[model samples]
Target chain A: MQVFKVYQQETLKYFHSIAILLFVTVGVSAQTKTDTTETKKKPTSFVPTGVRVGTDLIAIGMTRYVDSYKGWEVNADVDFSRYYLAVDVGSWSRDYDNGAEIYSNNGNYFRIGGDVNFLLKDPDRNMFFLGLRYGRSKFSESLQVNKIDSMWNNNPVNERYSNSNSNGSWFELTTGIRVKIWKVIWMGYTARLKFGLTTNEDGNLIPHDIPGYGRTDKNVAWGFNYQIFVRIPVRRQQ
Target chain B: MEFGLKAVNLSLQPRVSTMKKATWFIFLLIIIASCLNDPDCFRINSNVIGISFRVMGTGKSDTLRMYGVTTQNTDSTFYRNTAATGIGIPLDFTTTESEYLFQTTRGDYSIALKYDVNVQFVSEDCGSKYVLENLETTGHTFDSIRLVSRTPGTTAGGNIEIFRCPRTDTMAVAFRQLTLSGTTKSSQALVVETNGITPDFTGETLYGGEKVSIVYLPVNLDVDKHAMVIDFDQVEGGLRKLDLNYTLTETQRYRPCGVQIFASEMIINAVESQYAFDSVGFVLNETNSSIRSVLDPFDPMINIYRCPDLDIAGIYFRNRQDRADSTVSLKSVTVNFQTTNYAPTEPTTFIRVPLNKSATNTTVTIEYQTGKIETLVLSYTATPITRFRVACSDQNTLFTNLAVVAQGTTLVGSQVPNASLQSIPTRNIEIFP
Candidate 1:
């Protein structure tokens, strides 16, 4: 049911991706069938061969350098033929002080989806892919403000508002390239156009920033991640 | 046919030799990074809802004098004694609903509004602000109300238009003084001091102790005859009586505005008294007089004429360089053997002197703060003329061809630019001393 729910939310966003995915899948299947008929051997089985585990270098660098940001993301993918199932997990926290108010938020998030590799014939097994991701974040936020309303009799108000448990869901249209550098080490960059963000925090203190998503103010957000990965061979690729 | 994963071992990869592609990718990353920006701390929305007052029948903008405007559950008065055709009222951002009460001279009204308040984070320097949206008028006590816009912002026009029925029972009366400039006669507005004016039958004081040239008087809806007792500042015959007779026709012109009472074939009558008025007549729409609309509710319909005072003339001191009226402390002023003393604390630039009507000349003496006395002789010709016709022909004197002779006033002398004297005060003689 959760998977169905995620698919229902992502159907319109993944319309073009789904069409390309079907075309690539059918073409790859036809090629495999031709290879089997010519060799007269056992047919190709669309089973996982290897898995790539990676960490986002940009998130790590921001956590170390940016005072307002503290977060890290781990990305992993497993391949079946030319299609790869991708998963990402991360945690983020922010402390923002715009002089008049102090706002802070922290949470964990995870994104799970699939990627279709276009570079199927690359000798080095490099990848140039377009993918779709369903991202969800569980967050909590608080704000401290000293507000003085001059229109309402010049009364000074000192208040602290918080949303203890808030969660949000979003969609991302992602495109990236992954290239093998040396040995099992790989390098890649993913550019994401994140949009359609919906949050469950209806309280007075709205969530200023989400865990995976940077801020809730913008309708559409952009994200870029440069990652270094290690290829772990599950089965020998033949 | 069956498809399976490749069994080939994908090992170490060869590096691309093109440095241009790598440089282009790095440059693209730099451009995308430059595009990311922090939100600015500026507010583009307003918390106040704009309201325009319109008449029900005419759909024209109308003004109403507001005594005060206050909100429910709050004691703060945001507006007081303001006359406007439109106004901007603030909504409470803390609550989802607010009720505003407007106390006006015409009537009292209340409007309750409901909206959603969304709080958004601006920046670290600006903090969070509440954005009010989905504005709806839940309830109101006006004759008509319409929401022109759902969201309120800093914009022109109004978010709402409030309409009210036209006043059909009020009539404006103006007091006028007649003047003649060589056979071409004109009239100027005359403001009078009144003790009180009351409806004869109801004994309700419509006006009290005020000087006004025009007054809006409320008439009876049931009766065709209306009488009012106007007590003036006159000594002997100050209590003047005036009667109005009109035919009221009830017609359903606009369904939303309901039936309107139109007064027509109006006739005005006054008691014969020199101290009250010289004559009285209808000013506008005399044949088919009716209530136009609330927009022009104060249009004068009747003109009560008073004879001009020819015995009085104004004398003002003038600045030598700028030719402007200059104020001076005075000791006393004697005109035509009548001496009036003024306190040293009271400074004046102008004084009214009673000229001799029988004789063509009058003697005036003025003592300044320095105890220097100056004498002047004023001359004018008073001719009688038929001013206006009410029940009978009225006659009034016109003072013209004015001349002034000054003695012992040495500063810059005096000049009489306005040779013709008028009831309304004017600089007939400008004395530089």
Candidate 2:
């Protein structure tokens, strides 16, 4: 009971900070409304009149540091009331040596989805969302198996495997938070749980790693992305 | 108002966001720790048969030098230099036979092994493997054979124990008995050289068949052969023996020991006895394999057995009369074996005998439907059986002058009924000498 209470208290503290931020946003909106009334009395609208575009910071960091990871992604969203239409487009390629085998894959993928903002009336148009995405990747992969015949006196052997233009499609159930720390710029993380991809464990074509959705060796795979965005706000909502 | 409701919902938002971040963090950890792989190997093919020997009797302690030569051995001739510990004879990866000729100071001992060599394709990368299954030794130079393991995997372990031949009479020459079928009862049968019937060595008279010393011929690639000259009393009967030899060659062409000896000429070399040649009573006077008679081969049982890799055991019974040199007629006899349930497809003359038999009591019931016979030591393992049963009913009886004389006085006979297609009936006849 005591631990529960402590946890509840800690949770309540974070909520209080969000409440304080909400009050600041609402207070500014109210002040603007009052000023407009004193001059041209009208309330702000909720409809989004401009687009927000973002680049995945994780992909950028990976590409810069990891020799195998060469990938880039851009995300765009257009909001309408509490719902947003989002599209994630990315291209990735990997070339790595996994001890006994050398694996390489390269392709581009697109994930289009709609996210429903749970906070119906946030002042800064921030979003904490539950989203559903349809993701499809068209990639080709090749792996070469290298082995030594110890019984026959350690003879070295090499076998090459490659598939061109192979593709896969999956569904992602995602949850994300988009928070604005400043004007015209926002940063947040989206965590996705992907499903419905074929899980074949036979042959060299056993999907070891997928480009966009990560490793395909599991029943359900997960992906996470942190993005930095620039928003061009247009007309204010009523 | 709606504004009041929004304010109330705002209090719960921070905790929700905090929890979401924690969940995301945990999921991130899981995502980072995923993707495991199975171990890869360079090679995965297994194939070998391990054979070692344990010497028996007084010479069990003596490390008399030994080595072996297999059918797979390019030169299946004598191995005088290579010593045998437990000779690891590489079976023909393709055949069921892995017979090795182990030549010792005493003589050459032949060990016949049979096993089911099962091969399976592992993968395209690693090729295939030969799995040795049911390793049972039917031919050994000992009292009995025992299998250490039934399935010794793709890599054969040192599980098949070959009890080596006992060093009994090193000074005495080993003799193989051969019979002349169509000769008349005469007083003067000459023991002669291979080319002619001149009395090269005077022979002693014996009860039944003639005996001669075993000859290890020098290896010759181009039709090298051995022979002995036999001069029967009746010239016409000698001619009849020649025809029977020809018939046997044509009929039993696919002999198990792969013996394609031209039985046109025969030889009988002198047997080296430790005692005096005893100016009398020695059938094995002159030994020769060249002037081949129907019974030129000493061990008739040799023709029925195959190498271990073949999953089939065979047995054919030939009863000789007591102390007689000739085989009994196979006219009214039948042979059946009681053993593990055998596949009908196993190529065999005896039915219901498994390729791999346990060290249990296996019975070989030979029914002499027409008459009784004497006791014979069947050097057989479960001591060796097939698909087509070599069974005998009263009507479908096979006729052969096959004689086997037990070196004892206990007369035995097996009377198998026509409907006796199942287990052979056991007989208990005690005869005290």
Candidate 3:
């Protein structure tokens, strides 16, 4: 009787092994067939269900502590699958005094660009993007130029020009990455290369700083932004 | 999640250090290397082009005998070569044309050069600097003008080379006035009586109360001249008169209102003297060849001055026709004049006494051996209209002009010997002694 009971247990263990092997083979074949026949197409319900609004924290700090400078920038973006559309709006004002002269400018600028997120299907909704933007600003600049030291003449030659309204446009390429640090918070860094488009000419008063671009002396300029974003998902969960 | 946090740290820690280094590098590049908002307010900056003096004289002359260089009413003098060898003169940044006058005691000439100016922006601290390139000599008074450097830098090396002939007309003479270092070796009190100019500029002739040890007169008289004397006071042997027998020929043009073109030569009679030189006199001709420019009147543009009167005088030696042994020599002639400023203790004070007007009578004092001093007072004879000018190069031409002697042609204008004398505004009276 004991021998018969041990034979029965051995037979049941063999049958279980056979059943498990057949199940694995069928599952693997089914998965492979499904993968080979699958077409990658985005669904129709992609209406930017998530949005991230951010501000340049670095710029805020710079404007707060630095003299005669006041500026702030806000960035808002909406995601459509792997592509994100972003808009940057900023206003800058500077009352710069360099001992030789004083120049004051106040302007508002807007940048509209689209970013193609390279990090796809990430659980944390992070992104590495390559983007382009067309930036524009309408500004008024006033300058008071003092006379420089001269060997020929010693007269006080001071020139003042006020309310010189100017408009400038530029194209920029941006490379940046965003990392989700909290449940509803994110951080990002962007480096931008700006190519000039068009700007008004000032004979006596050269515009030193543009709202979207750094300086107008050269045809190209560089910019950097460190942002802190608050992520809000309307139809999706974080 | 706890293990996941550790994994995140592991992944990020290595990259953080690299990012930090890159950030520091970029920060340094922006902070230290970037230009600030300082703008150089100087719209124009001049470049310094250096010039030096070199003598092609094979006779081993020490330095070139040049008076000065003048441009834009500024004078740079090289008195007896008492300066550095090279000079870095400034170029006009506003214009491409520049003319400079190189003056010598005998004559003067113009140096003109053309250049294309380039402006480059330096840093904010320096503003900008002008670079002069494509330099070519348009006009010059030099024999050979060679470019030592294709583009001039701030090196002490000479840029423009001016070839000059060996000077043979230089003579060593002495003035009677004594200085601190005077022991009969150096010349003193160079008397310059510039005729054909307004006599008010330097106060020429002193008549009654005026006294002066030095004289630089501006005269507008066409017939104005000065009788000069050079002494051999330091000679070891017997006293003798100077042998400064030279020709004074000039090409002068007085224009605008009404002044005749005067071309004449004054010569000294050097008959039978033991010396080679007689009375020191020459016609330092107006050497500039251009007309008057509205900007600067004293430039080489005009060679005649608008004096009140135009009195032209030539040396007709009163006793040279006689050529007697008892004639007056330079040793028997000593001149005394007054200054423009009043010095209560000294008799050198003088003011501008017109040619028609007299200041103080000049006392001619002659001294011989053994403490013998003889004085000659030239009494005023109705305010002379013009004084006589004398010139001599060689002693042989000092004879009478009626005797058909050969005239000297050595004193030529620097521009040309027979250039057109029209509308000149400067008066140059050259003394050869």
Q: Which candidate is the best by TM-score?
A: 1
* Fnat, one value per model: 0.23, 0.00, 0.00
Candidate 2 docks with a DockQ of 0.03
- For candidate 3, the TM-score of chain A alone versus the native chain A is 0.77
- For model 3, the superposed segments whose C-alpha errors exceed 4 Å read A1-46, B1-433
Q: CA RMSD for every model?
A: 14.7, 23.9, 28.7
- Residue-level lDDT tens digits of model 2 in B1-433: 3554222233435534554654455354534433221212232223456555554322132243554354533344434566555544445434456666666665666767777654332223333334556667777664334577665533446666655433211111122212111221112222221221221123422212432222212111123242222222222122101101121122223322233432323233433332111122223324522223323212221111101111222333223345222222322222224333332332222222222234332233333324554333222223222321221111121112212224234444422212111122111111211
Error of 1 at B14 (Å): 15
Considering summed lDDT, which 10 consecutive residues are worst modelled in model 1 chain B?
Answer: B11-20
The digit string of per-residue lDDT tens for model 1 on B274-334 reads 5345666666454675433322445787787766555567888889989898999888787
lDDT of each: 0.72, 0.47, 0.47
TM-score of each: 0.50, 0.35, 0.36
What does candidate 3 score in Cα RMSD to the true structure?
A: 28.7
Worst 10 residues of 3 chain A by lDDT: A148-157
Q: Which ten residues in a row have the lowest lDDT in candidate 2 chain A?
A: A198-207
lDDT tens digits by residue: candidate 3, B68-143: 6666523333243333345555655434556777666536766787776544333334433445666667888764
